[model samples]
Target: MHKYQKLNIQKLYQIYIYLTIRLLMNVMWIVLAIFLIILIFERVAERLGIDRWYKLSSIGWIFLSIYWLSSFIAYLDTDDFVNMLLTLLAAIFSFIIAFKIIIDNRKYPWKNITLWVTISILIIFPFYKIPILRDFLIDMVANHTLFILSSVFNASGEIITDATIILNGFPVSIVIGCTAIESMAFFAGLILCLNAPLKRKIIALVFIPVIYIANLFRNAFAIYAYGNQLFQFGIIGTAHESFFWAHNVIAKIYSFLVVVILAYLTFKIFPEFLTLIEDIISSFKKDVDK
Candidate 1:
């Protein structure tokens, strides 16, 4: 009985340690996110010649306070309502700070930085927590892609379900990441970051849908290649699989080529974009040479 008791105690201790570690990890992630935001704000402020230590410090404190309060509410297990409310308040606060910074630094490239950061956040984080919107977007992309594939392969493919397609009995699932939203976001960010006219920006935005259409072609090609065994090979009675080539290599190459062509055309339309790209490339080369 004593041995069993001791074992139970050890197991309980292990579980306690695990929970403690998990809690700490969660806290660390929150703190790290806050720290990064503060750091980016300070860097942008310094660049814009608005480096007020007191204001930045206050902003950091506000973020830290929000994080701590939310953490406390979460620990109490009193629903996620309070936590979400606090998060919304914190976002508003951050936005106000960003707006003020932009207003005070109209001469600097604050607008570009703001646009880039905002679009990046929207792309990287699923702030839109609506499941229906997400599902609808994925379903649309998947269905359209499957339709294209069917046309190309003479109706050899069908959509099995939302965001999933079956071609020649091989199933492919399209997730949110596969919808090319990130690439569109990147293109939008680039266009907004460039020192271009409103007309050019609008024109660039008009072409944003082209990325989604290109992604459809990319998906169709990959699915068709995989289904038709376009790259399969064998050597001396040994069959070598080409799934990796079809799925990874072909998909990536197609996407990269499409983006490159689109970017080239866009840069031609907006010469400032080409200059920005050249500057970035030169700076990167210099850094590498160092």
Candidate 2:
């Protein structure tokens, strides 16, 4: 009886420890989100150069805080879909309010809009959890990627399932994060933020397709190499066997290089955007130096 009672005590203690760790983790996430929101608010207020911007931003921050806190708690409760929807709604509402406030302020419209839009995109992009939209994007990416692979490799590639391409009987699954939507969205945000003519901005949007194509090419090449066992030899062989290094390191390096080249070409065409990019880079450099 004493042994069984001791065992029960140990089990209860373990459960208590597990619950405490989970609660702490959730609290940490919420705290980090709050810090990020506060930083964004300060930046926006400074950029707007108005005291009212702080007040307006505080309202938005409140909405965001509720979204973050509730979402974290809901995640703990395992209601992920509802949490995502609630978070999205809250973020959109906050964005609308903040955007209106920025437009009303009107002092450096381009800069303010750019900052708000970029921050808004960064904030809400990760929380996207709509099932239908996710499936649609995956389908599009998978089908289009397989088509491109077939055209490039002169080999038959088919979509074995949604977000999965089968090449030579090897199945490669493409997740939402791997679909190049994030890169395209980032470029779009940058273009929208540019202090350029409407025509120039529209012209800049041509790079979106370029980025998508580049990503498709990257994915196709990596999948081909992986399927055909091309990069399976040498020092890379061991790493390739481990999935993380294979896809994230080798594959991501290639894709990042492609993006860098594309970005260079883009900046060459829209030289005005380079100024902003330079300023951003210099600011980062200064921060690092400090």
Candidate 3:
């Protein structure tokens, strides 16, 4: 046991030394790259004027990245005044944090930093557009799911041509923004951070449409129920209460439940899959030793 401990200690020491050298080299490269970029910018500015060059500096690049991220997130589903205000506030906070990271690292040249910044921006753009995508995908899923559900429920009515459901003279349109695309986008970021496998990440991608489709049908059915509310609203005797308001809440609740259920399933299955992977690695190591 003492000899085993010594071996482990020696292995760890070697790894530590190797990593220390790698870290030092990376830092040196970053510093050198930054200095070279700044020198080039300074020379260019000498000919182009200080003001114009300053606008294209490391600081300016950070500001642009921050602005782009903030503006993109801020633009999603700003329908409700309260939601619009909240999104704007969140965008501002996100920008500040991202900006600080870049500014604090401004010792590096703009060019070296651009790769990382640009890569992040590219990654985030698709997710930022998810709310909009959810709307369209949800509507498609909901409308189709409603048709299926209608068949199951043995309900009879003209299926409206667009994404609208008409019942008892009440028509409700399933807007794409009403889908859970935004929430899935948020969860996608979390899963990505967890370093989930490509297959598992693909599962999350699949869940987006599943959640959206479930939401779409939930909305459609709620509208159907709203139209047939002679059974439900008869208890309240509508003096023109918010048409479909209760049903809208129901649909939203159903979508939330669906998201929770899918997320839970993903979490459960992913850990088991990881365990399987670990087992495989163990088997491979044993084979190598043999």
Decreasing lDDT order of the candidates? 1, 2, 3
Q: How would you encode candidate 1's per-residue C-alpha lDDT over 133-206 as one tens digit per residue?
A: 77877899898898888786565787776667876766778888678877888788778777889998998886
For residues 246-286, write the lDDT of model 2, one tens digit per residue.
Answer: 46456667766877886787687667667765654554465
Span of 10 residues, lowest total lDDT, candidate 3: 105-114
Pick by TM-score: 1 or 3, better one? 1
Cα lDDT tens digits, model 3, 1-290, are 69999999999999999997775444323333443455457667667765434224344343453444445565564323344455566546434433433434332322333433333333444534466654556566556756755775555544575666666677666554545555555554444544447776676667656755665566556655666663355545572233434453455566658867876776675774344335545544654697
* lDDT for model 3: 0.53
Give the candidate number with the greatest lDDT: 1
Give residue 124's error in model 2 in angstroms.
Answer: 6.9
Q: Which has the better lDDT: candidate 2, or candidate 3?
A: 2
Residue 202 lDDT, candidate 1, scale 0-100: 92
Give residue 237's error in model 3 in angstroms.
Answer: 8.9
Clashing pairs in 1: none
Task: Give the alpha-carbon lDDT of every model.
Answer: 0.64, 0.62, 0.53
